[model samples]
Target: MPMAADIFDRARAASRDLEGVTRPAWSSEDQAAADILLGAAQEHGLTTRMDAIGNTYARLAGRDETAPGILSGSHLDSVARGGNFDGLAGAVAAVTALAAIRRAGMVPGCNLTAMGTRCEESVWFGIAYVGARLAVGNMDRAEFDALVRLDSGRSIADHMTDQGLAVDDIWRADGPEIKPANTKAFLELHIEQGPLLMEQDAPLGIATAVRGNLRYGDGVCYGAYQHSAATPRRLRQDTVLAVTELLQRLEALWHEIEDGVDPSAVFTIGKLFTDPANHALTKVPGECHFSLNFGSTEQRSQDRFAAAIAAMTEEIGRRRRVRFVLGDPVGSSPTPLDPGLRAGLLASAQSLAIPATEFATVGHDASIFARAGIPAAVLLVRNDDGSHNPHEKMDLGDFEQGVQVLAATMLDLAAE
Candidate 1:
């Protein structure tokens, strides 16, 4: 029997490998992370390969390779200042889960794929979930060509080339090689990253659905800059002020997302910056596109929220007289828990004698595969306060409880 300490030790070791390996955006770090996961998989006797866009696939051959497989893992990339555990934690857990089952002489029901996806953070192209998107055949060349990083002017295609992936290879992710039949279900075990489970005092939360989201960049705003002594506040058109107005309007619209919406319908104004620290610089950046997160179980409710939010952005931009170029709203097809799978997990939780609750996810790798029509479910480990800041931490007790819950769920799934 592997103690909790043993599991944590292995995960902690893997976490160390990914520490400070910040977003390569398009640099070698992305490739490096992929290499690391491939190596890890190889050690476990798992067959592995890297796709054109850096999405790594590792196979755990079951009694039957012809049977549809279940896949799970997190993105290998991180956001700027991303912690070592954010994405890496789930990756370690997936592989660890398989390793533990095998070492325990537990039999697996089907082929399993422990996937480590690339470009989860949009550091290179400002597009989140690139690895999952590529796996699902959502990323196209035209969109890839136009995407750019916040600080760097390099295009996404350029970054792919730098990572040893040709632009055409990225665009042409359409062959039978990248098809979706390999996955029967996608299960991702992740840190709650929020206080919901912990604050609610729930040992484990069954992820019911993932939040739908949209992201687009607005071109830089232009405005006159003048000395405080020379420029009248009333006469000057302030880019930041205009952007502020738009942001506030977005907040107002979000609040209107209906009465029965999920608690996670959040709209965040995450990043904002301006160039030319000098007082003389005019042409202030007008870009103020933030992400829209709509996480709910009901499709109609999500639809209402999206329509209302889109209208809100339009009206606010028009009022401010700033050109608002809207990009494709990353419409997410809602993924629900399989009733039979949920029942199996519920029974597993009962047998393990651990407390369990059901919750919806506003963010997750599980949702991507689930949206792609794979029956998917997420098992969450609790965190305190849900603050993603450096001060963020999780309860050791809850983490242990999570392992039991997860193990029980796995046993139940396999039994079926």
Candidate 2:
């Protein structure tokens, strides 16, 4: 097998959880994965370093040390029980590409750095791109310190302290370690979270934009519990029905917008359940808990979707005599990738004769970089199963193709 495959196998072995891999942000498993990447970088004669927030970097020096360099790679942390390849594949491919360039005796004009960022998965800290945001000086230190891990109920600051990181210095530092001033471009090689590439029978894809999302993790519908048989349809406040109707209407609005406004618009109700302890199935459900996520590449579409959700919930709640409380929403704006960089990646794909396409991608670390004013691009490899689960499948060959494109793009940017 290739070096990338070996690294992937080793990472999975070290971080294997009950059904999938679990490399929680700033946890031992997360560090272990970074260590593996660092070791591999060292083996390939690259210098390695870890930032204040535990983001790892492996540098392959170029001819001009002072010139702005090209940064690549992806996050190391995974959602709880997530598949191994979701984020790790990109980091591994980055290191492998740098190694390949070194072996081929190719020297660009600027440095190439493979970055393994932490806490890209929001499941842990409920905040996406923690490491990447900090790297670009976009994070608010106060907000970061206040964030609590979902499972541990511990603040992110406590987690960082426990991991032996200098929590205070992180905020006191002059600026971020990786900034737009020093970085020419950020290229991320990641697996397609959806089945787009696989369905297209293409091995790779270049992202055009990253979708921004509105996420409500704590959405609740409340009503008075009543006897199922005794309560008439007009009298009973059915929380379940109210919530279901809200979602159905929202989905319908999404379809409308997708057809006319933005074809990339998507809506999902990821979680919905009635209170199990309150009553049995015989009783009218009194409460429902759910999560709502709406995403689109256009800000206007997102705004329209948000308005529709609010209107629907208010109308349904008033009619059903229920109450809807959607917790504070959190999300980023849609980020367009660098068109020139994307075109260069496509040119490289064409030159290499790799079947590649261009499409919008879900949020990734590359989005953070692009938002920070650094040119960014995302190269996606084909994956069989969707991401954030154990079934994610990226063929080794497909990953190599992504790496080839990434390396070519990095070289193109570095030489300039």
Best by TM-score: 2
Report each candidate's C-alpha RMSD, comma-separated, in the order given.
Answer: 6.1, 2.7
Clashes of each: 5, 0
Please give, for residues 127-234, the per-residue lDDT of candidate 2 as tens digits: 789999888888877788789999999999889888888876665556777777799999999999998887899999999999998889899999989999999999
Off by over 4 Å in 2: 152-158, 161-164, 222-241, 274-289, 317-322
Per-prediction TM-score: 0.70, 0.90
List pairs with backbone clashes in candidate 1.
194-386, 195-386, 220-286, 221-285, 221-286
Cα lDDT tens digits for candidate 1, 308-343:
656755665455555544556655555666666666
Give the range of the ten consecutive residues with the poorest summed lDDT in model 2: 167-176
Off by over 4 Å in 1: 1-21, 164-180, 213-264, 267-297, 302-337, 385-388, 395-415
Highest lDDT against the true fold, candidate? 2
Q: In angstroms, what RMSD does candidate 2 have relative to the true structure? A: 2.7
